[model samples]
Target: MTGITDFTVKGADGGSVSLADYAGQVLLIVNTASKCGFTPQYAGLEALHRDYAERGFAVLAFPCNQFGAQEPGDAAEIASFCSLTYDVTFPVFARVDVNGGSADPLFDRLKADAPGVLGTKAIKWNFTKFLVDRAGHTVARHAPTTKPEDLRAEIEALL
Candidate 1:
């Protein structure tokens, strides 16, 4: 019965970040890549974060290089890209592997809690998003093609 709060992730600064600190908030956890085709979605994600933050909503981004080496930058480089390109205010975590044996524990749990299309647990691409409710339950799994703006309704429901 473990939920997201049971995990710890690395911050952009490479420090440990406890998921428990986000208790009572609705979260959109995304696997991102700086050089991917879907990289522009960061703007939409930031929009969602800005529009709903006061309502206890957040967008937690985790950069990953597993997808075609799309995110090859180091921590500082990734942070700089996010800030300069998208003006992202939400938390952008340290680089992590979102698939295979080296995947981050948090991402592994998320995929398990909300499997992809046809019950497949494997993530297809970068920008894949997992929506979590206030109780830390993963409510839905969104494909990379699912735009952030399209999630407003669901986010509102959770709020």
Candidate 2:
């Protein structure tokens, strides 16, 4: 059984980072898009990071342009938009595909760990979230429509 620690992802700066780096911390991994209707969820995600970061929880954002081209920006542009618009201080990774053969390996592992909507692993839209426990085991899958604030209680329980 592969855990999240087995995968590596690109950081916003174009550097490679292993999921192992975040091992032992509760993680909220999300595929995001700047121009989507759910873009406002950035506020809720940032709030969660601020609320629980000191207690070993982190929100990892991965910008994906696969959905309606809602995230067309490069790494710098995406990072700036997140920081300036929502004051998002959590880590935001480089843009990547959330579906199809070109999808990032990190996402492939996440989908395999927790399928959604009738065991389908394909990501349907932007902002789909995967919650992982401190041990790197994926615990829950939240659809794009599931607001970040709604996961607070669950995150708290994990923390």
Candidate 3:
């Protein structure tokens, strides 16, 4: 019965961030990578964050290097890339492993709550998004190919 609110994640500044801080907000938790083919999604994600933030929506970015070493930068580098490249204003968390034994606990719960296609729990690639409701429960899992702009309808529904 554990939800995302039960987990704690680290911010890009290496500080602890409680998911509880985001209570009552719809969250689009995305696994990001600066050098991946989906890297441009950062702009779309930023757009969503800006467009719906006042409506209690947020885009939480978590950079990961687990996918083909696509995100090999450190915290500073990741933050800089996000800022300089996409002007991302959303919360970009510390890099984390989104799959395998070393995966972050938050990701573990997310994948379990909303498994991938065909009931597979393994994340297929970066930019994979997990949408969480206001109550911190994961609602849906979007594939790497799913563009952020295409998620407006679902986000509006949750709002």
Candidate 4:
């Protein structure tokens, strides 16, 4: 079965990043948008990254414009917004479609592995998170409204 390590994603800086690079670390993969209602969640995500990074956890942000054109920005703009607003230090991937035919392959696998409410594979909105264990297996899927801070216990368990 395809796991996190089986996919490659592009970073906001135009460089290719393989999930294998993050292998052996618990990952909170989130679909983000700078202008969405959940935009403020970036702070909580950054906090999680800072708080658990030394213990082998990471928050991988992937900007998405699919929801409402809320993330209408280029890579530079996305990176800048994340840094200036939330002081995000974790990796931010290139803007991607989280649902539909154009969705990133990595997200495709994630949704397949951990379908959301009612067994729906489609990602409902921004800030949707997929928790991946140290072995690269997706363990849980959190809805957009699930705050990042609420995931502390799960993260700690994985760590």
Model 2: per-residue Cα lDDT over 1-159, one tens digit each: 777877888989999989888888999999999999999999999999999999999999999999899999999999999999999999999999988999898898899989999999999999999999999999999999999999999999999
Candidate 1 residue 17 C-alpha distance from true site, Å: 0.5
lDDT of 4 by residue, 102-139 (tens): 99999999999999989999999999999999999999
lDDT of each: 0.95, 0.94, 0.94, 0.94
Q: List the residue pairs that clash in candidate 1.
A: none
Error of 4 at 90 (Å): 0.5
lDDT for predicted candidate 4 compared with the true structure:
0.94
Predicted candidate 1 versus true structure: per-residue lDDT over 1-159, tens digit per residue: 978977999998879999999999999999999999999999999999999999999999999999899999999999999999999999999999988999999989999999998999999999999999999999999999999999999999999
Q: How close is every model to the real structure, measured as TM-score? A: 0.98, 0.97, 0.98, 0.98
Kindly report which residue pairs in candidate 2 clash with one another.
none
What lDDT score goes with residue 116 in model 4? 93
Q: How much does candidate 3 score in TM-score?
A: 0.98
TM-score of 2: 0.97
